[model samples]
Structures are given as C-alpha cells and as structure tokens.
Target: MSALTKQSAEEWTQLFDERYKRTAWPYGSAVWGKKEWVCPDLRNESVVSMDEGGSNLFWAERFGRELGMNDLWVKLCGNSHTGSFKDLGMTVLVSVVRQIIADGGTIRAVACASTGDTSASLAAYAAAGGIPAIVLLPRGKVSTAQLLQPIANGALVLALDTDFDGCMAVVQRLSLDEGIYLANSMNSLRLEGQKTVAIEIVQQLDWNVPDVVIIPGGNLGNVSALGAGFEMMASLGLIKKQPQIVVAQAEAANPLFRAYQRDWHFEPIEANPTQASAIQIGNPVSVRKAIRTLERHQGIVEQASESELADAAARADRTGMYNCPHTGVALAALIKLRKRGLIDARSRVVVVSTASGLKFTDFKLGYHEQRLPEVNALHTNAPVELPNDYDSVRRAIDTHSGWNP
Candidate 1:
C-alpha cells in the first residue's frame, strides 16, 4: 500500500545536485567521453549473443503508442544468456574486474551468497574467467537447477551450514579480508553490469521511454542499478524521457515497503522462507541505494501475496512464459498494482520474468499435474527413482531404459 509516485517524480533535481561530485566510472562527462582502454573481446560475442539491447532506445515512441502507454515503452532486460536479468550486470562487472586484474590489480578469490539466480549467474561468469568461486549457499533452500549450477560449471560450491543470511554474513566478513571479493548484489560492479539492461532495453526499443518500468526489489541493488542506467540514459540524451520505475517484493520480506510506509528507522525482516526465495532477504545489503533509487523516481515497492505469485505463475504458463516462483511474485505485484489503480490499462506494463521455471521443484503448473498427482508420482518426471539409495535409482533407470548409468 506504500507508494512514492510523487517523490520519485521530483528526485532528479536532487540527483542533479549530487552528480557534480561523483567519481564512479559510469558517471560524469569526463568518463562518458573518454575512450575506454579495455578493448572488449568481440570474439566472446561468438559464445554469447550480440543482441541489440540499446538500439531499442530508438523505438520508444513506437512501443509506447503500440502498447497504449503514454510516452512509455518497456525496455526489457530479462532476456539474456542467463534467464534472470542479472547477466547484464555480471558481464560488465567481470569485464571491469578482469581488466583491473590484468592491469596489476590484485585480488584473491571471488565469493557470493546465492539465492538461486544470482549465484547461478555469478557462478557461470566466474567459471568462464577460471576464477575459483567460494560459493556460500544455504542448505536446502535453493532450487535444484540453482544448486547444480556451480557443480555443472566447475566451481567450488560449498553448502553452508545455515540460511541465506548466514552465508551473507560470511561473505561480508570476507569482503574486508582482502582475500576474497564479495560478488553479491551489493557489489557496485554488479550494479554496473546490471545497468546495461536499461541501456539495451532503450536501445532495442529505439530509445523511446516507457511510462513505467517495474523491477523486482530484493537486496535493492537490481532496481537501483536499473534506475541509475535510466538516469545515465537521460543525461546522455539517449532519450528525452525516462520511465517511472515501480518495484515489487514479497509481502513476507518487504523491509523497503514497510520502511517506506512507516517513514522511520528501518527494521527489516529477521528471517523468511517466502516462495520468492530470490527476494527472501531479511536485510537488503543495498538498503540505502534501493530506497533512494525509488525515492528519487517516485517509485514504490508493492508487496504481493504468495497466492498472487501462484496466480501469476498460472498466467505466465497461459502466456507460454515459464518462470520460477520469484518471477511469479513480480507478476503478482504487477497485478496488485494494476488492481489498485497504481497501474492501469492506459499504462503499458512490462513484467520481468526472472528465471526458468525448471529450477523450482515445489511450485506446480496445473498442466504438469492436472489432478494433483500423487507426490510419489510427482517426482516421476526426474527420470530416475530410488528405494532410498543410488543403487535403487540405478536399478530403476536400468528397468526403465534397459541401460546403466
């Protein structure tokens, strides 16, 4: 129920006042005009798609009109090498970190606490760089695919003896150790990489500005990065207007929403096991930046019900878009905002589907099990069954496939 549509509408004046004194690589006229010495490995484009993301900035007007949204066309970033929108941030981040290390910058190992998506994205990138990842993962919380990512990608995945918070605590300690660099959403480099999504979205849509852009708010870094990207775009005159961003979060872990509502000292959730595991953080590391990103843009964090997440998942399946529960939570918030008149038919909506649905084991698609098939048969889709041991699983596989594993 908390909103910042008014405050965000007027945040640029303050941001403008502060932009003069900043020294970030992405900011300032000097940095913008300078020829970046790090020659991008264009050959890498062979392995990764050289998609036209920024080019969409050119068609903002066309998209806005077609979507029936006034001066607002969504520049989507959810489509990337990794399903979730975190790839853009990670790619740019790896580039910077790689260049620094190449130029005599010293660093030990890269570490992070993953909630399913971020860890997967980070693991793949870290592996590609040949950097041994010290991944701290909470026990039994991450999705199956997320859990296997580091293993499949050849990174050292350590199952922590605790929850996501405990893993983050370990990462925070390592950040100061100088023996490892924290690679969570809190790392500004991740923000830098993430900002490119906005750039690509605007580029792909011919640079027309969307009336509204919605982002999932977890540790706050993702949305904050997006806001900063749009702000940079406006400064570069890439587009005449920028979208007013709206953030979404689960009701169970909505410290930002609660803080915005109470307008007092923030008291984040102590813990949560919400369906939206990607956003189940108790205290967002990017707290201040997340709040300011919203406050500066007149945005709001809408907390959606878990049932809404289920409904949204159903909608996604109906639309032929399969995503994990975290994505469903984002869509749920979108629907909630629309129902509340915070968003309307007049507003063209772009919901970011964060990850592939295959990652989840618990959430169900009616199509997957129309009759709520027995939980015994529920796991039948896994291709192997066991009588409580690997030998049994092997026997079942041999019986089913007439072969050995």
Candidate 2:
C-alpha cells in the first residue's frame, strides 16, 4: 500500500492505462489489470480469470431522452463469462483458494448460498481453477438459466426447500468446518475483485466521476464494493469528487429501503416474491457495510414494486436494451427520482446493470405476453398473429405498425 502511494497519481494512472493496453496473459483481464491494487501478493499462476471486467459502459441515449436526461449510461456488468457482475468477484475468490491449496492449505472445496449469480460465478471460476465448488440455492426461486450454470460447471448443487436467508444460514454453519471455505460476499476476498468495477468505470470515462451511480441491491455487498473503489481512488487522488450512490431494490425484499425510510434503523423482514428474484433477500449479510457506504456516499435507498419494475424494464427494452428485472428496479428508482426532481436532467448518471436479460427469459416472455401478475405490461410487444399467407402477414404488420403500403 505504501509503495503504491509513493507514486504520483499521474504515474499510477499512466501505469494503469498502459497495463490495460497490454495483451499479456493476466493483464488482458480487467480485474487482474489492476492486480497491484486488488491483490498484489497473489501470484500470477494462482489467478483464476476468464478475462472478466471491461464490460461496456453503454450510452443510454434513447432511454435517457425518455427520462429528460442527456447523460444517462448503463454499465453492462452482466456481459461476462457467467452473465452477471458476480464474475468480477468470483475470479478473485477462486484464485485465492487455489493459492492457499498450492501453499499446502487444507481447503477441500469452496461453497456459497446464492440467489443465483454468485453460485454461477463461483462454480465457473472454481472449475477453471480445478477446485471443487458447492452451491446451496433456494429451490424454485432462481431462473432456469441461472440454475443451470453451476450444474453445467460440475458444482455440487444443493436445492434446499428454503428461502435465500435459510440457505445462507445453513452455508454459514457448513463453513464452520475448516475444509469448506465460504465464498459469499461476507468473505471480503470477493470484494477485492468486485471493487475493480468502479475503477473500470472511471477509466472508461477518462477518469471522470459521474454525478450519480445507481445499482440494484440484493445481499448488499456490491454497494460497499462500489464504495470501496471510489474511496480508494479518492485516497490515492485518482478522483477528486465522489458520486452520490443509490441502492435500488425490489419493494418485496427491501429491508435497506425500509431502513433508509426509518432514518437508518434496520430490521430484517421475511421477503415477498418479486420478478427481481435475484435480490429477494430478507436478511442481507453485508447490511452494516452497506450502511457505512451509504452514509459515506450520501446514499439513497429506493425500491420498485413488481409492476413498476416490469414496466420500467420493458420500457427500456423498447429503447433497444434488454434489461433484467433487477435492472428494472434501478431504472424505476431513477424514474421516480427524476420525477421528484432529485436528479438533474443534465447530470451524468450511471446505472449498473448487474445481469444479462437473457437469464430472465421467463420474466421477459411473461411481460410481453401480459401474463405477469400485478404488471400492466405497458410496453408489451406481442407478436401479431396471422394466417400462413403473405397477404395476411403483410396486412397484419401494416395494421399493427400503422404503415400504409
């Protein structure tokens, strides 16, 4: 840490820029490109990477225009090996496990209780590193695409007849055995890689900080990880200003939002089911860390109902984006805040899209079919049914699209 601090901020920035341009083995990876800042002690041979990070910071031009803003961006974190931001962290966790085993450590396997993305990432990274993985999931809660990831990666998948909180409880107990290492965000090692997202975002934007960054919240570790990155940059003079962080959550599972409403007095509740199933956590393990981050960053916690999230996601999709329901939660929050004039129209805002919409095919199909409960499906784009004839198809398309031909 002292050695890095000794270099001027300009030198550090130039070093990072140079590393990013390199096509070397680990440097090609966005996380390992900043390895000195992330895990300097970990050897290159021990690093498990699928070149995660360096996801697109997309310009939401049409979507922003709809919200009366011109500077809206979405960080597509899901465009990775496992189709979620969890890959950013799992690479680091699995690498550390490999290093420990190489050093004669007695770790047998790594395990985690996941709503979805974490297990997928851990399984893939563990497989890549030749380490075994065990994943406990709340049966019937996760999407089929998410459920299949760990199974495909050869992890010992356990489908428990319990909610995420229950699975979390059991995994914590299981990790009491020294051979079974916990791979959840509570482990802290994962955050070392996840924090690199913030650095990457700034780097993509030429080291300029955004005015606001809104991220979907579930177990809440990512929020703190995001904060850690910005805080580290400020400490090292990489950024002069910090963005106001916003944590968006599903109303059905919004303990953090409730806490924020009650002046930061937190209490866990039995979460209700929502389309944003990934974030359907009743008791988040990283609640304290999240609170500290929110406090330091002037954070705001906002929630979206099932209908709101569905509509918001569909609306964004209409503007050429395939947003997951969790991204919808953040989008819905952005809409509400914009309507309330809390966010300026010209402010540069970035919403972190945590997972790929491809994983939520059911949610997308349900919305388009207008079959999702409580959702109006305001932007439904159902296909036009027609007889098996060219004339009929042309007529249907003309009528539906209001085209004269």
Q: Which candidate ranks first by lDDT, i.e. highest?
A: 2
Which sections of candidate 1 miss by over 4 Å?
Answer: 1-78, 365-405
Q: Per-residue alpha-carbon lDDT of model 1 for 1-405, expressed as tens digits?
A: 012223342352334334322444333211121112112231222122122122112223432343344543323344444556666556555545555566676766777887767777777777776566778888888867778877787767888887777889888887897668778878776676566566545544544565677777778888888788788666654567767777888777788878878773478676566767777887888888877777777787778766666656655444445557667677667667766778766765555555667667566533244322211222212334346888877767667842211
Give the Å error, residue 315, model 1: 1.9
Given candidate 1, what's the lDDT at residue 74?
28
Cα displacement (angstroms), candidate 1, residue 77, comes to 4.3
lDDT of 2: 0.94
lDDT of 2 by residue, 1-405 (tens): 677899888988888888883689798899999998999999999999999998999899999998999999999999999999999998999999999999999999999999999999999999999999999999999999999999999999999999999999999999999999999999898999999999999999999999999999999999999999999999998999999999999999999999999999999999999999999998999999999999999899999999999999988988889999999999999999999998999999999999999999999999989999988877887777767899998877667862211
| Global lDDT scores for all candidate models | 0.61, 0.94
Task: Output the number of the TM-score-best candidate.
Answer: 2
